[model samples]
Target: MDDRKKNKEAEKVTITPSDESTSEKGHLFGLDETIESIKDAISDFESGKILNIAIIAPSYAGKSVLVDEIVNIYSHEVTKVSFSSIITDKEEIPLSEDQSKIMIFDNCHYLYMRKIGGFEVLHAFLNMVLEQDARLCISTWNIHSWNYLGRVLDIRKYFPVQIKIPPLNSSQMKEFLLSEYEDGEILFVNDVEAEDKQIFHVVKKPLAEKATHGRIKLYTLKVNYVALRSLLMNKGTPDETAESIIIKEITRISRGNPGVAKKLWKKWLEYPIIKTSNIDKFSPSINIDVDSRFILYLILSMGYIKKCELNNIMNWKCSVDDIRINMILFELLNQELIQINDEYYSIRADKLHLVTKYLEDCRLVW
Candidate 1:
């Protein structure tokens, strides 16, 4: 594999012997509440509560890290199975034959198809988990796939205790990233104001009370109106420091995602110095057309894609209707929203959050 592929692989969550231990390496910021919740669920399960867990989080949100810790803690007691992204077959997930009463599945989303309402493997897996009383199952899924499945199958019903990991704040982000480096080794440059920001054109969406459950749906079309209004109208200009500005920018661009923030930090770091003046915020000017948007979501859903992969995904989605694949690819290439390396097209790490935000605004990130 190439260096790029190696780097991508490095970004993927993996299990190590140290992860199974109560070492400092397993420590994570802003996850105390989540860890407590998982412990409580485990306690309940031990008490014959049968509350299997669904650890739901967005892509690259450290779901695997958390799950690895859990499995490491219970390695001697439970059976563990991890699914890979390259998986295209829906084979039967094997059961443990060593009389283990608990099982843990990572990337349970891989069991299902990405198409709308396509849950053949997931449905089977859920049945297997729900039907058997001899085994207690803990599964994790991508937030997007979970939401889609919830809409179609009410997936929450299967797992009574659902743990939705919350995003970290600026302070948490600082402490988290700072753990990787020593004091005075890195500097943050802060900037003020929202003047001359790039404009992103999005399709105006209409929401009914039944559809959105609240009036906030009306505010979906206004991009960052809350933040922009606060910055321009309510907030006062004070003496800003480099650390504060860097944290804010990191929080904004990464959307409080740990993985994305780590990648951004690596890119921004210039040996021993980082300046906000040099940090260019990439606020993408999104063109929210349906076909292009759908294609982006499908690609994001899977880490990387080939033409054949998209065809398989569209097969389940029934979305290959009157759309020119070549034209869309060309347009995306021109826009630089995605990058193609050796015929395998993938999103650039720097633009991950921009693409995610665009898809989220389109309600495709869910």
Candidate 2:
């Protein structure tokens, strides 16, 4: 056999689908409210009022789509400039524009770092926009990063009209599923179990007896890219690969952050498949070497069964090591995906709901 085929066969992993229906894009039922909000922002700016608006929230909070919708719908007047994973060169920012122009810069956080050496140029660009009565929309993961932009770019004068895009609620999730996945599956109304402590549900829904810090986390952009790419890679033909199914399922586990979802999906894809039912089966067990993106996912699953501690999980059939646990937990805590309480940590309730139905669709959880 060819080495490549041997390698793939050696790494063969098993995944379960929640259901036949899940979406792979758009505003399922309608993001009219969100779309209108963007249009309103544009209207306010086009009326000779120079505006600096900041779209802030956890990752997967739909900041890019919100602005993208505006740009897509009003392409004549809106100019889209993306700054993701690229060095920000201030000179490259479009500065010469009339009042009718609406400039959208996605991922502004990468630009304000002192290391980039482009903050001053960005400041100059913003100034030019204000002077020309043009509107500028900046997208970022959170408002905290804006402090860097403020310090370097002198945006305090603008104070940036902040618009918070909250994660999708249950109704919105249904719309998302309809738009992204196929139709005919039900959205989650309650959490369900797969087996033992392997809980499955949407990322934004409440799990059975889950502790809450009253918050939700979206995946980081890097994590999202990883997950989406992994899904595409595994499925091979874009046919009925488990990647899309994993996407919906992990969405319940990872919420909407493409990064976290990607990691978990990859891990799930990489998990060892020990035959259980002759039809090919593998029981979900904690294992080391899971990508850091699934830290919150493991933490969230703890609630499905009591007495499953962090240390014990490392020893499960999944073969998770202590070092991996420390690393994953540390990353989750740093990202605010999971908050530490007095002794235990819990997944953000909002995120749990987001991917709940996805899990159900994959049949990963009950």
Candidate 3:
């Protein structure tokens, strides 16, 4: 590893045991409709309708939370199986002979890979789901993988009841983020500089050559305003409190993703206070070749993957060797587009939106 990699490794944040506990108890901010839909599906199943459900959402958008909620509701009848990594063998899937009437599979995306002959495990799993008539099966999938498989194998037909998780709005985000804290416990500090807080700034500009001389150019002060979209959004909201402003900014930046919002909240929080100035607005520029783009898509689709897994996927899919794979991952790491935690590489929480946008633009992700 180079110095930059060493420095990045050194700067990585270590999550405490308490943080892990809090994360495991994830909040269900915008999943009421989803839960209702699941209830209706369960009711249908109870009425002799063998309708299997597929819950689809992007990574870190609370798919697991939704699964946990389902298990909680049907605690006496649901058997939950969660896959933490890619499942290459059907034997890896659990076969429960318990009395539970409903089977819930979390992270079903792991059942298949994007490479050729990768659908064997998934095909077997689907057959098992189809052949079983005694239990109602509910599975969760990454939205991108779901789309791809739906197009390729018509996978949607297998699951009649498909529920897509919705994003939380600004108000909902505020409520969810502050749920664990006392009212007014965390101070929202507005520490933006006067110039940055204003819609316009006066900048000095040099005149054209016709009005300029060597080292003596005519200078003029020009009034320049911020982006039009930003101005319009904040036009009639001058009376907004610091807390409201911070929440709105977080909602917009996170694109209403609860997982992302929580990560941002932790990043901005300084014990009992958060400052507007602490919000990160810097977007990393991504410019990589086609090979690197595909690798990035894999990382995004998997949420987090080990380097060895990346090598295996690349070698199977495109016959790319380990050395080239390492180079591409290094480039991505050097740009700070992705990060490594506990030997798993994943898109940085703060750069999730930027990375997703880039992949969407390149048609690497749906």
Question: Which residue pairs come into collision in candidate 1?
Answer: 144-366, 189-276
Give me candidate 1's TM-score against the actual structure: 0.75
TM-score of each model, paired residue for residue = 0.75, 0.44, 0.83
Residue-level lDDT for 286 in candidate 3: 88
Writing each residue's lDDT as its tens digit, candidate 1 over 283-330 gives 668895797888888767655567656666666333444256767877
Model 3 / residue 294 / CA error / Å: 0.7
- Which candidate number maximizes TM-score? 3
**Candidate 1 backbone clash number:** 2
CA error at residue 231 for candidate 1, angstroms: 5.5
User: How does residue 307 of candidate 1 score in lDDT?
Assistant: 62
How far off is residue 344 in model 3, in Å?
1.9
lDDT of 3 by residue, 203-288 (tens): 55555645574445555544323234456777886666779878988898888888888889999999799997887766657899
- The C-alpha lDDT values of all candidates are 0.69, 0.44, 0.78
Candidate 2, residue 139: the lDDT equals: 40
